[model samples]
Target: MSVRIAVIADDFTGGLFVASNLEKLGIPVFYVCDTAVLHEAADGEVLVIATRLRFMPPARAVAALDGLTTMLDEIGVEHIFYKYCSTFDSTDEGNIGPCGDLLIGKYGQRRLVFGPGYPDLHTYVHEGYMFYKDRLISESIKRSDPITPMNDPDMARVLQRQTAETVGLLPHRVLHRGVEFARGYVDDQQGKGVRYFLMDCVDNDDVATGATIFRHDHITTGADALAIELISQWTSEDAGTRRRTPSPVARAEGGEVVLVGSCSGVTLRQRDHFAQDNPMLDIDICEADEDILMARALAWADEKLGAGQPIGFSVAGDVASVADAQAKFGIMGAARKAEAILAGIAKGLGGRGVRKFVVSGGETSGAIVEALGIQSMQVLPFDELGAGSCISRDARRISLFLKPGKIGAEDVFSAALEKMRAP
Candidate 1:
């Protein structure tokens, strides 16, 4: 199969989310951690490269994409899609707009389309304002996020703060006119020198319609839902050749454990809701001493594992304590320490015969997968929260469910566990 789309995801979980969606549509996909492995797996119909540039500075994110375009060009991949979190997670000094700018510069395109709203996940953008399940992002729990606190709900305004070019809106009204009209409208916008567009999508159809208008060379942006739409269009040309076929479900044999390091309200609810029936361990970053915290957590986990109980680990504390830790150690410092602890616990538990894993937060999941020596994973279907199983590509072959943290429901953890254990 020829490579139809080359995706550059901002983080690991985001890459898996896109890859899972593509796989569901029967579009063969190969996901790589970095550019070095691109040569090892070049035969898949779609290539999703997971880059760690999302949390970096704009200059760094742009710099990271420097040699990437040349590689993509040589590979004969014409269409490039830049995927970020559906929640639009980034600071005013964005890795989104800056990274988008770099792609535009490399492709020499006068216009680019960008939107993070995934209606299936209750993320929507209308009239240039972002809404998380109808609540404006500024009024949502994301406002309290320690990393990229979404203070302004206006996406164009938010993106304008990051890019030098003017950000325009491609409202739902344009999409309602149909894909051809939308394509014409986009062309008109490009003629006006509008380089960046914040498109509105209320549902999958809206995204599909918007995606239908995209030329093979036009750069598009959004979450996995957008990619689903894009892939659907590309595959429809040969419907008989690329239809979904059922396969036997793979059931993992082991108890499950969940580790959460993301402080998003969505993850907080998932962790707390799943905690109702599961054993819980909370890591207090304010404990100040890493050795003592690690020792205590390992002891507690060993005890739970010995009894064969499903356990949970969370790195969240009370508001005041978290603030104090951030104030003392700085945000990056605190995050690194928390990830280290979680990675250590993951390695320890995996060594003790634990195979089933549910990891929340991108950084936390990345650290655990790396520590567990998981180079790649086979995506498995789960519930609508976009949670899916990833069997480790290595000989160890552990099962994992990597949640996007900002997506999923309060019962997402339990749902994922149920999926993992399903016969």
Candidate 2:
């Protein structure tokens, strides 16, 4: 049987790289992030879920991530691969460096992966302008900006070395990839099983088209189709078995539900998706003013309480930024409002009733818990990186954290709610 797999991230390059290396290992895998796409791709087999972290603001990108966390927790994923957002700047991924220790300590039966991820699109373009003004590609990243990887050679070296370390630590090389070319130098290269790879639509296509086609705008839509094709090569034998169809309607009632919409420009649309099963309100706490979110949370609680309905909230949103290094610095901005909601629910409980909040979405999970002073709340645990610290109480509700990049299937979110319910 092929090695089943799933990959999550804001971008696509990382997935291709992972798949390329894994293909050599003779392991089959599937790379996915979108809900519709992932559901279409799953097979009933032991699976690995690889998720990438970006350095953008949490508010812009946490919703989808939370959705993924919920799905992974409910359905269960075997290996946890975390590729921290890469940076050309020195302080790209601060405390996140120790993610391996974090996941393994908390969640049982899982592996650890940490990527000194590549720079986001803007960071690459802007910094590239400074690095290679001689070629003159895009004007957006003007020469005024300092060059990265070029000017800061030390940062590049650190990232290169760490990228290798990230892939080298995996249990078996059967289904692993090295973003940095040199990481997958394994001894058992002439091994047994078939190593396949996962890929999103765009990146997969680009890799398929290789040097034969290189246009100016062509790279924009470049996808790594070979990754998907490789997966197809392996999954074709037993795709029917690994595939799963989630329940159409939520298994439980959506009461006192908390709504977190952090995705940009598409807040109401995303809210509608959630509202399909539950009475969801579009509350993008990340972009909305902190005070506004607090007021909204209070109001949401009050409305639910008046109806004698226990509130259970689901957090979702996008938190993308131009330069990840600059935006994630003071992450407290995203944490405060989420903290308020958790605290409000806690206070409303009066230490008695069934006070439970189903926290979904990556940014919502991380920030909300942090706001209530809960440090390392648990989400979809991979290993040490998954095990976070206590949510230090600032007189707030109990907080929970979820991993990034996933689909919020009905069953998965339902499971999280079940975990939060009073035992």
Task: Choose the strongest candidate by TM-score.
Answer: 1
* Shift in Å, residue 72, candidate 1: 3.1
Error of 1 at 228 (Å): 1.6
lDDT over C-alpha atoms for residue 57 of model 2: 37
- Write down the TM-score for model 1: 0.91
Scored by lDDT, the top model is 1
lDDT of 1 by residue, 362-409 (tens): 877878877887665666543365745677655666888887667777
What's the lDDT for residue 329 in model 2? 32
* Model 2 lDDT per residue over 255-347, tens place: 334434233223324344545665544454445555665567566656656565434443344334413322543444444444455445434
TM-score of every model?
Answer: 0.91, 0.34
- Count backbone clashes in candidate 2: 73
Distance from true location, Cα of 113 in model 2, Å: 9.4
Q: What overall lDDT, based on C-alpha atoms, would model 1 receive against the true structure?
A: 0.77
lDDT of 2 at 129: 25
